[model samples]
Target: MKTFISSLLLLFSFNTFAAPKSELWSYWNVSNEKNATTISHQYWQQTLDKYLITRGEFTLFDYAHVTDADERTLNSYLRQMSRIDPREYKKSEQYAYWVNLYNALTVKLILMDYPIESITKLGGLFSFGPWDEEIITVAGKALTLNDIEHRILRPIWNDPRTHYAVNCASLGCPNLQPKAFTARNSDKLLDKAATEFINSDKGVLIKEENVQLSSIYDWFAIDFGSQQQLFEHLKKYRPELKPFKGDIRYDYNWKLNQQ
Candidate 1:
């Protein structure tokens, strides 16, 4: 019975029931001029600086250490983010807004049930992750973490680096950036994030005839295009990765990314 249940959970985790495609919600595909306005992520930045702890390659959030005051501050930041309409801003600002909002909400969700073992354990027996749960309403459109990541960011930006920027609150996922993203620093942060994750063990590790890769590549294979394209993407960040064609495997860790 235990083995059967474990197999079921694995299938659920690996897109048997959760295949989110990069389909744009046309309502949010609009954007204003590049310099039309500026949005500040200072509160989010402050929150990250206070809570993120770097342990080697993994930067964990101090979920256990968050204070009432800090939680209030985070809630306030989230409320402020929800009030604004991102489509009125330029694509760069919108990019930062969506990424920050997704991450902040994820943190908030974790705190709501802290001390949990993994994010996949949320929502009960059949729950794989809280990704599809409707958490907030923006512009009168109810949204989920999946909505933000797959529908808005991925389709609009059409950048594979979107995977690197929007963290999934898991150890195998890319780092929850220590600094909040902004129009001014989004590009640089995205580049740095891509470089870091791709070179790490979670991204790509080649050992003789066997190669292991993060499930991000497998899940979003369309984003990276093809096997050859993925190799180029990995090689762009980690030049030491030599060309190889051999046994390949994909894995992900779903443990809560906390200290």
Candidate 2:
């Protein structure tokens, strides 16, 4: 009976009842030049058309399983990161590494669970959410989300745009760019992310003289340029908004980003 019970427990652990993950590196190709779009506007239209973001969308994840491609891709990226000696990276590679890890691990999390209500829903004690996993082995060392963010991203690359590229799978989160991150165009990609989000109704609010906005601007106000710079940045894309005088309030919907 004890043996049978152990076998049942093992089976349950391996059950196929979990969320589905987003496909990775399938055809995503980020530009290597600054100011060049990470993903073309047309591609954004095509991809989003199929995977529209709606409320209450949930994706369950399996913390235990990973595909060969998933493993290979993450390992490849992380390995490339490891190869850059820290001294050189501070001058060049660190920012790219941080963004790459942020993006790569996000993809890994989606793959493991396939479908989750939101990335934040992966709970744990203290700093041990689903973000804390040794899922990807780099140079034979296991790395988790916390390691990527706290240890790698924050410490090395102090740039504010790091916050924009890492998607937490929420409505309030920045829009996910449909391409891989590389050092070549990191500056441009970050700017685009900032621009797109700032102009988005989801990010900014313009409703009949009553404008509510995303708290992201407040949370990472430092990232949106300076106080006056924020409005200036918006003017480039939303000239009409330049004239609108309305109360600015931030709205953040933390529900899962579902299709």
Candidate 3:
């Protein structure tokens, strides 16, 4: 009976779901830098400037007040993003492009189905989340949020800070910065975002004698390295976490990060 139950549990787990394959990882040469026109993220910056609201360490979007103009501007930005070939630009530019695209697309999806409690509530049957759906086609290949993160950004850059940069439109996730990430300031922006998130309550909690952390660390454990590495990473951002040593728990809030 135990064996049967284990099999059933495995079948139901979202972790068992396979993602669609894409050539994004193999196609781009990260080391090669060719002179090319930089992709402009002006429309994304405008949309963010209009809707993003900062509250302490967390940032929320005024999803309820998103006007028709906002929608148009967001659509224009996505369209513009689709036209560019990531290979032409430098690696930093490509990194910023994918991060901005992932975030902007997330906001677009949330706005499309506004008034939802969480992004996980959207999408069709048996769809654990919208991350697997092909939301955009770039360079003749359809890309999903999962593809952009796992296959492209995370794998290509191998930077754990990438997790802090992409917003999932949830209170549990890191704040979506009010400014679009640019090649010129990607490093500073990523570092600042990591620091902000680590120090925020959403990232870590000390209750009684136990330590609780965001489920992000659990979900992307490989990306952040081992548990000890994660603790070290957290300490690097917030020195206050250094003294906490007890049973570790992880939690995440799926509530829409809205105003």
Candidate 4:
């Protein structure tokens, strides 16, 4: 009787606690190996490459609606992430979680269908749909983007770089970094992203006399420390932009970041 009871308990445990489909992060590992420049770019290139090679559509995976990704695979990845102990997770995981949630949610949105407009268009109850609050089991806790951002990321770490990492799936937002986020590499990745975006024409374009920048700067100026500090950071990469004296302006495109 004891043996049978023990076996039954073990079987029940496995059934109840067996790894789900949302905890695996291996995709990011495969993605990182494909590009050396930065984890952010590697992530983008890998997804794009895979989609282009197999599906012949770069924008197909842009929404969480119509992605070809196996939901079982994604759910498994999320499940593993959920199992990570909060204490064991380093401070950098805060940033990593933000990035992960953003990417995962973005992918989830794209998987639904080829959305023609902005993700915000899914707004409802508050402004966004269930995707906004939809919970995914992570680190043994079921959490939504709101819980990840507000309860975990924002509360644990207050770095301004976070603003750059949580992309809104729009052109005006910072390009989503493409690598699996880690504590050791997050700072470098964030710094690199900020610098690249500020210098990129798509981010902050300084065209001789006319300067056009991402509205992110205007929306989250507080996160960048100050306007001067933000510009200084940008100048570190593009010295040419430093001397350009022109009207500083922001341009925001609501178009979805799909190709």
**Global lDDT of each candidate:** 0.89, 0.54, 0.84, 0.55
Candidate 2's C-alpha lDDT?
A: 0.54
Error of 3 at 247 (Å): 0.4
Q: How many residue pairs clash in each candidate?
A: 0, 17, 0, 43
All candidates in order of lDDT, best leading: 1, 3, 4, 2
For candidate 2, lDDT tens digit of each residue in 2-108? 99886665465335322222222211122233332222123222332334333322221222344465456555555555453332323334455556556556655
Give all candidate RMSDs, comma-separated: 1.9, 11.5, 4.5, 15.3
Pick by lDDT: which candidate is best? Answer: 1
Is 1 or 3 the stronger prediction by TM-score?
Answer: 1
Predicted candidate 4 versus true structure: per-residue lDDT over 115-175, tens digit per residue: 4476655545234333445656644455656555545554446565666666556666666
Local error of candidate 3 at residue 232 (angstroms)? 1.3
Candidate with the larger lDDT of 1 and 4: 1
The estimated TM-scores of all candidates read 0.94, 0.58, 0.89, 0.65
Error of 4 at 202 (Å): 2.2
Q: Residue 237 CA error for candidate 2 (Å)?
A: 4.5
Q: Choose the strongest candidate by TM-score.
A: 1
Instruction: Candidate 1: list runs displaced more than 4 Å.
Output: 1-17
